[model samples]
Target: MLSYGVSKSSSRVPHIVTFCCNNPHHPTTTHAESHSVVTRRALSLLATATASVFSVPVLVSSSSVRYLEAAAAASTPRFSELPESGGVKALDLRVGDGDYPVNGDQVAIHYYGRLAAKQGWRFDSTYDHKDETGEPIPFIFILGSGKVIAGIETAVRSMKVGGIRRVIIPPSQGYQNMDQEPVPPNFFDRQRLFTTIFNPTRLANGEGSTLGIIIFDIELVSLKHL
Candidate 1:
């Protein structure tokens, strides 16, 4: 006869131990059999051990990780190679030969000035409350008579009447080493001060005040006979 014994610990926390003995009558028996009660006890003990070991803790995933990755990828920089004037990209022009004109020519224009970073306007003739609806005022200036900044005069000399153009004036040709009202002296040292001059004209010995970055949308209103 063959005998199998199984030992177990407590019921709430159970452990099992199995022992087997060979039968004298079955000398060549490679397998052994156990009673139903013992087999069931062994299985119960195994189930208890598995439950204790597998009931620990685990981590789960959320959308935060995916959102962060997407944000980083979107922040990548992009570059372009194109011509730029007065810090403004020129897609087209309306009037003028794209050159500066001489003095004593009647001119009309509309303009606006603001910081390069799109901050609020530093100065704008159109926004003056004195004019109803704040319309653009027309003005005239003589070229190269110390009436306007060197940059503006230079740009005007290249323009013709009834022409519109964009001018990019560096600080060197603009205020240059001087400071004026509204434009503080500190700004003169900042090399990035530029202007866009639209249409402009040369007045007849009409000396104009020197101003920085005068972008004129000039129409040759009329010219004085030489």
Candidate 2:
């Protein structure tokens, strides 16, 4: 399984075993042959330590090895594609407890919005918007209010408080056809951007019609029942 660790600089990084097998007792033939005698000795020591932890003898079978690999794969993040929503996909970076928000519930979130067309160009980020005391200002809206884009609202509907998700939104569910209120705290710039996207001439030429895929890294900070 993946182990996330924070460094002194507060950067998150994964620490994983040297091999996917992760069985010190039975090293893969390829790796075993390449390693020096000293490395083999180290693996032997690790096997001894592992045995001490579990009194039962560890049997390495093909089925057991496959199970271990599958378990490790499950620990990694994978996108769950939503059907009938124009190919919208969401990957939960952090899953939270509690019930998901329903209609009319007020939800607040901090998000990093990027555009797939422009090489993941970050269009906006709530983290960049800070209060006077220096706290990031979350964007809040009532669920199903239609104030925000469809993709964002759809993803938030399934998120619980403290859950973080990365959503991929196709143009159809984004700013292609409908008009949405400008997102704060850069309302003016966002308004201008949306206005351009909604322009008749631009839409006709397919210039801004395909708003391109939008990538949102959204954190459901909190929710309140209406």
Candidate 3:
């Protein structure tokens, strides 16, 4: 009868030991010697398996690091370009529900106006328009009536109610030739500075003639068909 038992070796390694009172073996080996050889072989296999198990985590750890680095690079925002529409580039920050406004519709909006030439100098914002009670006042106008700048009107016409959009207006589609009402608080002062730098020679030469290039973050609050 052969029985198997677990025993610890001098090296403190655990392995399976076979015990046999009388067992067939090589002519040079006794039953006890065969048991010892079997135990050593078992220990070697277990040690190799233990090493293999620990090595897996090292490979997974390196792979996980690479995955995290790729995720971080993908998360970085890029603003080198934007979609253009009829020479006026527009980017929708939030898409709204409901029907789109059309010509003759009474539309209400809020906006933050900035000058591109002044490194995005904020000139005005509807958020600043407040009543005596401190409630916000939205700017209202009739669509397609030329009540606002052409670029803003064009951008709004393409938006749905409650949508928010950011537009970049070139000088041709901006405040050129228009002393738009509800002007900036420092419009006159800005005009004085603008006049000093206004160059007709550059204007005719197709250079930087007009400093009217502006940016606007506009949100269409609501609209009513008139």
Candidate maximizing TM-score? 2
Model 3: lDDT of residue 6: 40
* Candidate 2, 1-226: lDDT as tens digits: 1122333433222222344357777556664433334343433343333111222223233444344344435444568877656678998877878679999998998898877756766678888888999988888899899878889988888888888889998877887543573254466657555665566676678775355578889889889998
Between candidates 2 and 3, name the one with more favorable TM-score: 2
lDDT by residue (tens digit), candidate 1, 1-226: 1111344432232222333455455433232233324444433434444221322111112243243234334433222112322332121144444333456653333333333222332443322323465543444555445655554455445545555444544434545442421231234322333332111242122322322333322233333322
Whole-model Cα lDDT of every candidate shown, in order: 0.36, 0.67, 0.63
Error of 2 at 211 (Å): 3.3
Better candidate number, 1 or 2, judged by TM-score? 2
Could you tell me every candidate's TM-score relative to the true structure? 0.35, 0.60, 0.58
Against the true structure, what is every candidate's RMSD?
Answer: 30.5, 9.9, 23.0
Residue range 159-184, candidate 3, lDDT tens digits: 88878888887766776553643355
What TM-score would you give candidate 3 relative to the actual structure? 0.58
Clashes of 1: 28
Please list the residue runs of candidate 3 whose C-alpha ends up more than 4 Å from where it truly belongs after superposition.
Answer: 1-85, 185-210
Best candidate according to lDDT: 2
Which regions of candidate 2 are displaced past 4 Å?
Answer: 1-76, 177-179, 182-184, 187-192, 195-210
